[model samples]
Target: MNATTVLRAVGGLLALSLSQQLAAQEVPPSLAELSLEALSNTKVTSVSKRSELLTDAAASVYVITSEAIRRSGYATLPEALRLAPNLQVARVDARNYAITARGFNSAFENKLLVLIDGRSVYTPLFSGVFWDAQDVILEDIERVEVISGPGGTLWGANAVNGVINIITKAAGATQGVLAAASVNGDQRVGTIRFGGRIGKGRFRAYTKTLTLDDLQRESGAVSLTGMQRSQVGARADWERPDGASTLQGDAYTGALHQQGTADIKIAGANLLARHTVRISGGTELSAQAYWDFTERNQPNAFIEHLNTVEAQAQAATLLGASHRLVVGAGYRHAFDRLQNGVGFGFLPAKLDMHWGNIFVQNEFDLTPEVRLIGGAKLEHNNYTGWEFLPTLRLAWNPTASSLLWSAASRTVRAPSRIDRDFYSPSNPPLVGGERRYNIAGGPNFQSEVAVVAELGYRLNLLSDFTYSATAFYSIYDRLRTLEPNQAGAGSVFLNRASGRTKGVEMWADWRVTPALRMSAGAVAQQVRTRLDPDSRDASGTTGLATGDPSSYWKLRTAYDIALGHSIDLLVRHYGKLTRPAVPAYTTADVNYLWRIYPNLELSLSGTNLFEARHAEYGGAPNRTLSGRAVGMKLLWQPK
Candidate 1:
């Protein structure tokens, strides 16, 4: 069915349901009701592996609250991420995104680590996430904590640049029925969920579907085909006075059209279980395990089937009056089978990979106003035998509403299958009297490494305004490069490049009035690299990685017009890219929401209102242009 037809059907169903639930209900408390001081004190766990106030964390972090998600009118996770100034996000197509922090950004960005409820989502093949395959009910997310620096000491390899932790609300807190539908131009989305009690535990199940129309090229011709996806998920939680446990699972499938080619197909499923308990000496212990399966088929390109299993456990305890310690260990195994296409392939066709790591962190109080944090991790992988990651941090609070912090760390991006086993032309055929492949795997590839230092400050003034600023510098070595082989027949992956990066990130929030809030954020950075004297790279040293913007900024405002009405506006500007030469662009978005009834809401939103169409990434003819879009949504949550 077309997007319009599906949208109309879903809209009609929601309207019919809404009519029966017209009674007024009590509105739940929202983030806007919290004072700036209270918001700055939000609890976060990604930085230290333990709950701590956001203002006390020693990392450059940003939290996207649930209320922010609802006010932004973003239907996808990638879109919602644009709110974080520390991140650089670009849409490559209808289903693909290039996201990163500091530097080194690409559709297959390998330096960032992402988690959904503590489950790693990066594929072992390239140590990168397939954004198209990741999704969740936006309304169910408690908060998204984004840390824009190395977290390898705790998260292990691939956390060289940043980490994103998506935390969801417990089923017990979402006990009700929710149905929502949205239509934007030729795109449509629909979701239905139910939550209730099962014995002493709470359970929730949901189904979501989305369809997007084809995108146009600079010439106004269809460049990338449209796509459709469907997903179903469930979660259950049990809590006791001293501990809690959770079990959740998800299954999804999607299809995308390709001009003059067969449709691309994808499907995946995952199951996870987590438990936490209080132990002796006022200690806390937590454990989790998960299994995941994924399948993908791209006609004339390649097909793959992968299975992964992982388990981890951690404990937090107070060693003495001045010291707090956290220790953790994890293990992961992945098995995959690939069917090579004529264009490219991964050698061996089928392979098994293993990874294991153990980490320990200690927080020592130096005085009433100062503290020291240190941690280290020893990780083992199939390709790179063993790698060590370590970090140190110092934080001081001169006043209750102000903080100063500094940190230094060493991290690495371990070799993936692509770095050591990739090959172009699965089976090379004789061409122009040559039977050799164009690209061959690197037999002696090693992990890329980086040493970084950062300084930051945070302040909350008069309980009405809050601001955070961070400055960082990094030196990188053993970076990836494609060097010509001795035989001069093909190129192989190597680590012969070095570079440095320096940047600043800042953001602030202000309550302009009792009903109005304003926020602003910006980031600026520079990257420089050089190749070894003996290195003969086919592409320039900088070509190995994707292009990056030198700077970007965003501004947002939210206003509550009345008891049940609100409006939000956002504006963002991105710096130009140098490699492929994409021009800079600015976009503006606005949303208005009305709570018709206590349990029912209607919203109207417009995206890219300032421009008719623009390009965010990629070069000329093939680059897709995003046009202005408007959407309407209806949500019903029975209390």
Candidate 2:
């Protein structure tokens, strides 16, 4: 159906749901209320496998609270990621995004790891994320925790550059009804949530759809086609006298039209279960398991089917007063099948792989204010036998509001099917004629590794001002490169290059008054690589594929007045990027909300308000937003 048709259908559902609600109910809490909750309980788990304060966390971690998500009107995870100035997010198409942290940003980038709840979303086929395939009910999200550096020692491979953890709210907290819809020209989005209680437990169910408008090329031709997606998900939480458990699952389907390629269709479903039991004082044990099924089909490109199952167990205990310990182990099995196309395909067509890892971490307190942290992980996989990653950290708290910390860690990016089995090429050249060009995988490829070190300082400079600064340096080895084969017939992937990347970033939060709050951040990074004397990089981007945007900055201002009214403003700027040389650009976005009734809120939001059209990524399709846009949403929460 067309966007308008879907809009009508969703509108009908919204009206039906609203008609059953009370005339007036409690208003949704304001930003201040949400921010206060986050500050008191905004836990960071991805950094150390245990929850801790964001400032006390020994990494460049940032949290995007639910209020931030609501005010941004991003509509998608990729768009919302732009809030973290340390991340590099670029739109490649209406439905595709290139996102990374540190550097090495590309549509097919694989150096970043993403998780939803406790489930890893990175695909085994390419060891990268298909941004389009990742979806969630934004309204159900509690916070997005971002760690902008290596986490291999604790989180495993693919955490080379950064780690993103998308955490959803508990079912009990979302008990109510909600509907949000917005219109930006031809782009439209609608999501409905209904939550209630089952016996003594709580449950929530949600369904959402997205439709995007296509952009026009400079020549008046369409650059990219519009896209559509439908998704449904549900979650339930139960707490007994002895233990607590959660069951959640989701299903999604979507279709997309590429500029020149055959249309693509995707569908997937997953179920996850997590259980926790309190053992003793300050001690807990937990178990988690999940199964995921996904399929992607392109008329002429290729078809991929994947089934994954994972199980893990973890424990956290206070080993005496001065020592705390956290330990965990996990096993993952993936069965994937790929059908070749004229474009790219894996050699085996079908494969089964298993991944296993075990980890242990010890937090030792040298004194009341000095702490030493040490951890290590041992992982085994098909491509890489046994990989050991270790980390060392130290933190010194000299005052109640100041912290100084430093860490050193080792990480690796294990090879995937894409690196060792992929093959494809344009039409072959006539007979022996040098073969126009062939791109094949390297059977001898090895896993890429890096050693990273970081230093950080955080302080509350004033009663209302707080800030954090972190600087990192990393050295990479066995980086991927496109090199000629010994036969000189075609090029193959090889580990023949190395490089160094370093950056410094800072974020500040200020509360000017009881009703006004602002947060600002900026980041700068530089990446450089050198090829071996005998190696030649066909794309030339080998030395710079990290596609460093050089720098970026963002500012967010939120002001709340009497009643439930509030205004949020955001200004974001991106620096120039090389490799294709994209000019710098800036965008301004704002959202205004009015609580017409205690149960209903009306919102007006504008995105890309500073430009007619601006490109964020270079090359194919030249993705961009078309003109300034305005939209509205209805946020209804029944008492």
Candidate 3:
């Protein structure tokens, strides 16, 4: 069907839902049963890789529950992340997202790691993520765990910046048919789901799809590069008095056919099983196994296809009433086959790669108010042989309403397939040789490692207010860089330099009443890199220095209206970037949502709300990295 037809149909459904809500508003729920204190004290898991009360956790963490998602009216995962503090969200074009935590934001941001129910989503080809290819039914998500800072001791590679864990609800929580659709300026999204109980377990399945309008050019002209995506997922759970276990999986099959541009199609899947056992010794043992795969193809791009596979197993046990121990290992094997074409070189041979790691951690409670945590991980990979990572943490609970914490950790980021073994053509013809010379990949590149120290405090200020603040300093060694070689236009990846990154994050929340809430967050960071004593900058200089402004802030306000209704407003501001070639500019966004009914909702959101002419990063004169985009959506669930 055409876009217009689909939109009209969705509009009709939304009208009916709104009418139903208006008819039911006469009888609102009692105010005594709901209050603000209860919402701010909710528990979360992303901070420690385990569940804990938000007020009691040591690290900085944020929780956006299912209700929050519904009330915000966001149509996609990336859209929702804009509400988070310390997060940098930017659109680099028609099909790229520049998202990061603290700093180092880019289209293929490598500092941060994202997961859906314990499943890692990083790609082996670029050592980054393709946000456009990742989608989920927002309604099915129980909560989003956002942690700022290193999660290496627990999460492994690419956890240098932070971790975003998208946790979905179990089958039992959603027990009926649900259908939702949304429309706005240039994007449309729809979702459907069903849930029920089986013989011995509960099972639920869902599908989400989206079609985005073409991106706008600097002249306000559309790029004719729009894309479409679809995703399907399911979850099952079993619980008897004896214990509880759960199994979950998802499959994403979609085509990114851009008009008049190179089209790429991808298919992927993820599966996981978790088991928890309570022992007579008062210790709990838990284990989980997970795997993810992705296959992609871009007919026009020289680098034609990439297939990746990742699998992992982890186990944890409580050693005593005050000590918790964890140990587990896993492996990742990726195979890449490429074809040569314009601006690209052929892969003389296919590449086979493997990554393995094992880790352990101990949490000790020294006193009723003080606790300590320590851990380490050993990793082996094709490029880097044996490597070790260690960490230590100290936490103090002054009262039931506040916590102070500090941590020290060392971790590494291994090379990708392209970094260790791949070839490419040169851009802007080299000083010598043919118009293009293949870039060289090395098998001797050392892993990127860093030592990070952090301190933070969390406080429950008043009956309806909460706040968290954190500061960190990191020293990086063995950074990878490329230099022109004698092999015509050839460049190699090697351990070339050292750098330092320091930053602070602060967030505050205030509940004006049971129906009104407000939140604000901000980040200030700086990074500086210098060429090694024996190394040379791209310009042949002995030293070159640079850093991005890395400063940004966000504000949000929400109200829960009568009769199961709510509305939210959000505004985000990005600071002017000033380093590594300044194309700096600031921008803002506005978003709103309305819960038309308990089982239905509608949302309207837009980025670059003022159509600000700004550049978050990159320095291409013709770069259309800044603009405005608006969208809407509808969600429905029948009891």
Off by over 4 Å in 2: 1-29, 33-41, 425-437, 461-463, 620-626
Error of 2 at 93 (Å): 1.7
Of 1 and 2, the candidate ranking higher by lDDT: 1
Off by over 4 Å in 3: 1-37, 219-224, 257-262, 302-313, 340-342, 345-349, 426-438, 486-489, 539-547, 579-598, 604-607, 612-615
The weakest ten consecutive residues by lDDT in model 1 span 17-26
2 or 3, greater by lDDT: 2
RMSD, each candidate, Å? 4.0, 4.8, 4.8
Q: How do the residues 359-476 of candidate 2 rate in per-residue lDDT, one tens digit apiece? A: 9999999998989999999999998789988999999998977889999999999999888887775345565666434887888999999999999988765457778899999999
Estimated TM-score per prediction?
0.95, 0.92, 0.88
Clashing pairs in 2: 104-546, 612-627
**Compared with the true structure, what per-residue lDDT tens digits does model 3 show for residues 511-561?**
777677788998888877766776543642112223346677878877666
| Model 3 TM-score (2 dp) | 0.88
Question: What are the lDDT figures for the candidates, one per model?
Answer: 0.89, 0.83, 0.71
lDDT of 2 at 198: 90
Clashing pairs for predicted structure model 3, backbone only = 181-634, 182-633, 183-632
Candidate 3: what lDDT?
0.71
